[model samples]
Every structure is written in structure tokens, then in C-alpha cells.
Target chain A: MKIINFILFPFLFSISTFAAPTWYPMPAEAYKFGQLYPKAQQLLFAFDYGHALVYERLLQNRGLITDPKEFEKKILDAVMKILKNPPTVKVDEDDIAPLYVYTFPLMVDTFDWSHMLHQFVLDVLATSKDRGPAMNRRVNELFIDYKKNKPLAITDVCKTMLFMDGQFFSKDFRRQYPSFNLLIWSYHWFQIKLYEALLKPTKAERDIAVDQVTNDFWTLISDLPDSADFDMMPETRKEAPNFYKAFPLISASFDNNHMLHDIVSDILASKKVPSSEMRKNGIDFARMAMDPEAFKSNNCGAE
Target chain B: MKFLALAVLLCSQMLFANQKAILVNASPNAQFYRDLILKVRQSGEFTLPIPGAQSSLTYSFDFDQPVFPETLMGDIHDSFNPIYFFRSFWDKILFKDGSYLLINGEKLPLTCLFVSGQDNRFSDKKLLSPLLPEFVLKVYLVANDFSCQGPVKPGWPATGGREENWDTYLYYEIKDPTIMLPMDAKLRYRWNEYSLVLVDRGSK
Candidate 1:
């Protein structure tokens, strides 16, 4: 009995040693930063839920693209309901999967890496002291540090737009999934605009900017397929040109992140690949086809 | 002129950079605490096992350089990692596992910790991010009756800037000059104060 147990220990140890994937998280304080940008945070929260639902819907047998009616019934209608009443908190992504590991095992981590930076910039703005010192310096400093963090970092801006424009990827997903696509574009619009708003001097002012952005989100989202928001994903460089001017890498990184999100959805909705491999293949397409490891972006008022 | 401004900045940092820590021996009931410390080391995944908590803790990587982020907002860990100590002390406990004091139901003297770090660099490249110019967190395992050998001594007067206290508070000191990356001037590097500590302000 002892000999049998001893021999089995090695095998058990090797199997047990298999490492599990983990989420990339923002600094603890980033969560507290939500207080300053409640609406944007809520939208960000909704985006988390939206990602899971959209992915799960795409995984549905034959999905909507195969039968346009089911797509409207299952995907479009649900998004409209969500727009009317959004979630208040960022969701626990683990519960979203009816089937554990439905998306690529790394999907949650990949989103989390970009999400952490998203919140990190918010925290920098949120933490700025009134009239104490310029925050740009610190914001810029932290941005550089954030990129240095890997396994915890999603890629920065890709040099090319072809990844989002390729055969497997294009406007088809959004064209088909308008409401959900609009919802995601709404998330990016405010997320990018908030950077511009954060450059405001005070939280009260920032609060007002957030409200305006929120209103802008609703205005655009309500316009449906013809909405102005659907024209293009929010370009950080164009929307918050000063921020983009200062920290092109982080701005580009964030823009790339949103672009990839859309691109991956396109790949999934197209259903060219097997449902099981959709997410895995999509992630591969994102990293390999669109390499943004070189440029991360963020801007504190100073260097 | 620049020297004077720099001096004031440094002086102010010296006065307030107090990341005080309390190292309680792992008593019998605290066996879980001891084992956890042993499991995490030299900067890996860290989640403080706040009993009955539903979420994990995350580090903000304080960016103020010599200063740390706010650790506690009240009775909660505002934004900081759990006890980070040196890897060398992974097996250096002095108390029997599971032996700890309970004061009003709160576990006394939490698990031992050792932070390895260095002087905050002022160079342009090094100043990019918090994690860029920082060290790692290690754990210390000791048996019962093991008092902390780290810079922070129990019941030391607060804010005096003693050699041991300041060094521990700021997280620096050299045990081995040869192997200096971990030490490079970092031991007990500044971390957010995750727990509340009562200040004794000299009898009012």
C-alpha cells in the first residue's frame, strides 16, 4: 500500500502543478475611482455583461447570422432592454459563462488587462488634487509603468487598421448586431471622452463632463442604426487629441483594444470557424494580426 | 535654489512615510495564516484572506515614489496588498503554528512579513511606473513566541524615525551586500496601511 501511494504521488503532483489562468487586475484604488465617474463606470459594467452575453449568443447553435430572425429576437432585443436599464456594478465575468471556459480561456484576462488600464487612467484623474500640482506628470509616469506590466497588459495600439478591416473582420458584425454594437461603441465613446473630461480641473467639473458624456451616449444610442455614434469608434487621438498628443502609446493602445473587441465579435458573428474555436481563433487573430505591443498610451497634464 | 526645494521634499517624505506593520506569531487557530505566507513569495499572486470576505485584494502600486498610497479608509483595507515579506524568511517562524492572541475577537499579531525593496530612484527611466522601480513581497514563517526581527519593533514609540523604525517603515536595509537586487536599498518598502493603527499622541 505504501509503495503504491509513493508511486502515485509524483503523477498527482505533476497534474496538480498545472497552472490556471488568472485575471489581470487594476490597482486597488482604481475601484474607488468609480465614485468620480459613476455613469461611465456603470457603462463599463454593462460592457462586461454585454461581452459575455454577445459571446454566449454567438456560441448559440447556428447563432443569429444563420437565421436573422433569431439574431434579432435573442441579441438585439436584449441589448435594447439593457440600454433602458443598465447594470450598476462591474460583473463577475466568471458567472457569465453558462459553460465554463466558453470563450478562449484567456478572454477574461485579456479584457481585464485593458480594463485595468481603463480604470487606472480614471483613477489618476480621480486622484488629482485641486490646485495642488499638475497631474499630467504623474499620469504620464503611471502610463509608462502600466505597460511594463505584462501578462497583465493587453497589447497597445496596432500600427494598422487592416486587422479590423480584413475579410474575416469588418462592419458585418456591427451591421448585423447594431444594438449590441451600438452599445459597445457607446462604451468606447464615453470611455474616450472621459479622458478628455478628466483633464478638467475639479471633480465637480469632471462630474458635469461625465453627465454630458452620459447624455451623449444616450442621445447616440437612441438614434439606432442611423446614430452618429455608429459613424466610427471613438478615436482617442481625435477625441482627446491633447491626451493623444502627449501619450500616443496609451491612447493608441486603448483604441486598439476597442477595435479588437469589435473585430473579434465580427469574426465570431461571421461563423467561418467552428463555434468551439471561435474565441480562441479570434484571440489569435487579434494578437498576431494586430500587434500593438510597441505603443501604449496615456497622458498626465505634464510629460 | 533647486537643492533647497529638493531638501524640503525629502524631509517631508521622511516625516510621513510610515507603513507600520504588526507581526504576530501564527497561533494554533491561525495555522491557515502561516501556511498562506509560505505559499506566496518573491512577488506572485497575493490575496489577503480576510476572514469571511467575498473578494480578492489588489495592489495599486503606489506612484508617489517615496510615499505610499492611502492604505486604510477605516476598518477596511482601502487599497493595498496583504503582508509582503522577504523570501528568506519563508521558514523562519518561531511560534508553534496556530498560536495567536485574540483581543476583542480580532487576531493579534498577524502573520510575519518581509518586504524587499530599495531607495526610490529619481532617474527619468526608473520613474515611469510603480512596479518599474520596486521590489517584491516575500513571506515569513515562524513558530510561537517569535518576535519580529525586522525593523519594526513591537510597542516602539511612533514617529521618532529611529534607525530600525525608519528603515522598516520605508522598506530598506542590507542583509547581504552581494545579492543586492532585492536589497538594492529595499526592505520594508512603503506600502499602503491596510489596517487602522491607533496613534498615541503623547497623552493629548
Candidate 2:
């Protein structure tokens, strides 16, 4: 083990020393949705912090959680604290989890790629006029262009069965970390709900709808859900039904991605894995989830 | 096009109003501000730079418009320069921070300042707001900063991804009357790279 660490330490340092520039073409509708409804974006701003902070805290305090649920509670408290006054700008993720990157470099890239999809949808909806026909074309164009670059696209199928409490899954992560998991679920709950706003034609109508959704998000955060209670991961088909009709494949991918959000968290927080091997375990789960046959789901059961 | 004329008109109006209403112990050129505001309001692009020491900070702005997207650094040129660039933050870290803030003295309630910036292309621990007067400022919107970060990632269109460290901020500038405010409508640093694209999100 010592020898392996010595061999890999320099590699990590060098990779960090000379990294590639990360950027993307801002979708044509970059900040338009936010301009249309500032509060909606603010909600997302809070989630960005929550999302990154979760990975940071989990990795920072790996193996400390003998009581996963209790730890999840603490994490929720932290997320709510952040939601109260989210940072006005994005914080450096690499800065947040520098040491962890030495091990889980792949997770960082996958997270960034998935995040771009989230922002891309908001952009598409921003340009799409209240779920009009143009919505389909714009979304398709973006999906095609985005897929062309792939941007670390999660092509494999990470089925719901993988997340089941089998031998691989344990009580430590999910049973202990319910609220934190729910917080993520809740973050996603609103992610799909955001599309409903597009159904409204004008800015004022969209604003009113977005405000309602924003209010809905705050309700969830302020009244944290019961521990280990993600209440079943949100499905794009169920949440974004209109979108489901338009882009079934893409929509399924998002639901799969959301499920993996939990899967990764589950594995990271599990008591089954030793603290030292958590990164390796996370990568394993990431790989399995990336496997198209395993991760991709055309239908995650009717319900 | 009309903002300059409106600015001049607003200055004159402030002068007129301040002289006419002597009830509040008005400052010497009290009317200049009101006139400038009215003129700006009259002229269409109702963007105003915060006056005083902080007002001098360089700024570059890009509205979320529909058009071809370009890297912020790419878009920035001789005619359009942001008040603070990536290097500006670094320079401040090494030397004295160049950002100016005279708001403690009474100025029109500071509200929502939207700054367009970049993120870390490399290692930089400098977080601008964490070091500033945090109590006085409330940050509501921060993107491009967090969304684009971490290991070998692909770039996207319109932005210089994680490598560029491009970010944005919308802060609520508190209105304090104690501050000695500017009389003219020029709301940018001395270099003045771009016209202020600031909008009134609301006042503090």
C-alpha cells in the first residue's frame, strides 16, 4: 500500500500541476432563464453549493460516520445553512476537494459533465418559449451537439436494482444519510419542476410559475424530510412528463443520472467499504453505472 | 447612444432639485446625482455605476443575449475591458487588493451588483468576497464559478470552461447616505472599458 501511494502521489501532483482548461460554449439561452426568473436560478445556486459540499464533506470525513443517519442530519443542517445565503458566485470545486481528487479524479470529471447537462436543460428551456415546438428542436440540437462532444457522457445503464439494499448496498449510507440523500432528491425534485415554467408563454406567466416552484424548493429545505427518506428517487418521466414525450432517451438518461447521484453517495457513505478503499469503490460504482447495459433504463418500472 | 445626454441632463436636474429643495441640508452639488439619474432614466439603458471609491473599479459586462457565444476573455478588447480581470484578483492577492468600496459613508442604498468574472484555470485560493466586507455585502447569484471546475474536462461553447475560471456575481450594494457619492453618471473605473450593463435588481 505504501509503495502504491508513493508511485501515485507524484502522478497526482503532476496532473494537478498541468491541467486542461475546462469551459463550454454557453448555450444561446445561457442566463435568459435566470433573467426571466432570478429566484429560480438562485435556488439552483444553492443546489450547486449543496452538491459540491456533499462530496467534499463525505470525502473529508470518510469512515467517521458510524451513524450514517446522524451524519446525514448534520449534512442537511449544513446544506440548509448554505441555502439560507448561497454564494453569489460558484466556488472552485478543485479547491473544495483537492486531496480527494488525487484518488477520485474520474468522479470529478463525471460530476462536471453531468452538471453541464443540468445547466444545458435550463438553457434549452430558457430559449424554448413555454414548451413550444421550438423546444423540441432546440433541445434536440443541444443534445446532439452535447453528445457529439460527449463531455464524459454516462452511456451505460445504472439500473434501480444496483441501488437496492443487497449485499453491495448497506444501511450505513442510506439508512443513516437519509436527509442528505433527500436533500439531493429534493434538489432534483425542483430540477424537473423547473420545466413546468416553460409551459407558460410570457415572461410574467413564467415568472409567476417559477416563483411558485422556488417557493416549493424552500419549503423542502426549511422543513427537512425525515432521515433516510429520499421518498424514492424522482423520475424524469413522472416529473417532466412533457419532456418525457419529446425526448425519451435523454429523459431516461437524466433519471438514470439522478439515480447514480444516490448510488455514488450510497457507496461513499457505506460502512461496507474501508475508508481507504472508498475512492476505489466509488470508481467501481461509477464504472458499473457507466456500463450502458447496467446504467441505462428505458423504464424504471411504471411507478 | 442617448445615455450620455441623459447623464448630463440628470446632472443638471439634480443641481436644480437640490437648490430648490433646501430643506434637507443638501450637499454642494446635490442636484447632480438626481439629474444624472433622471437623465439616465430618460435615456433608456438605465445602468448606473456605484459612485465614489468603489465606482472607479474597472468592469466589463455581457448580457445573456441571443447571438454567437465567445469566451469572456476573447470578447474583452481595447474598447471593452472589465474592471477586474483574472489577473486583477491575483495582483490584489500579492499586493493590496485594488477593489474600492466607499459605501460605509452614506451612499444610495447599494443593491445587487452583477460582476462577470472567470474561474480558476490553475491553483488560486483567492476568493474575492470572502476577504471583503462580508457583513455589508450579500451575494445572491454566483455561477460559472462552481459549475465549471475539477479534473480533465471538456470545454463548452460561449465560455472558457473550468480552465478559464469564469464566474459571475450579483451583490446587493447597501444604500448609505454617509458616503460622499459621485456627481457625474460615469459609473466605471478611470480606464472605463465597457458601458455598464447593470440593471436595478432592487435596492438594499
lDDT of 1 by residue, A190-227 (tens): 78887888777777887787788778877877766567
Q: What is the DockQ for all candidates, taken in turn? A: 0.01, 0.02
Leading candidate by TM-score: 2
Candidate 1 chain A TM-score vs. reference chain A: 0.78
The CA lDDT at A67 in model 2 is 52
lDDT, candidate 1, B1-204, per-residue tens: 999999997876554333213311221122332333233322211122245663222211111111112111111111222122111112233333343333224333223334332211111221223222222222222112235454454455554444343222212222211111112111122333232111111100
TM-score for each of the candidates: 0.51, 0.56
Report the C-alpha lDDT of model 2 over A1-303, residue by residue, as the tens digit: 232233223422332221422435656675555555656765676676577656766765665645556566666666676677564443434433443444566666666666666666776776675466777777777666555645466653436544434436544455666667677888888888787566557767867877887787777766656432355777777777766766766766666667667766666666667777767876766565456776334555356
State the local distance difference test value for candidate 2.
0.48
Best by DockQ: 2
Instruction: Quote the positional error of residue A179 for candidate 1 in Å.
Output: 3.3
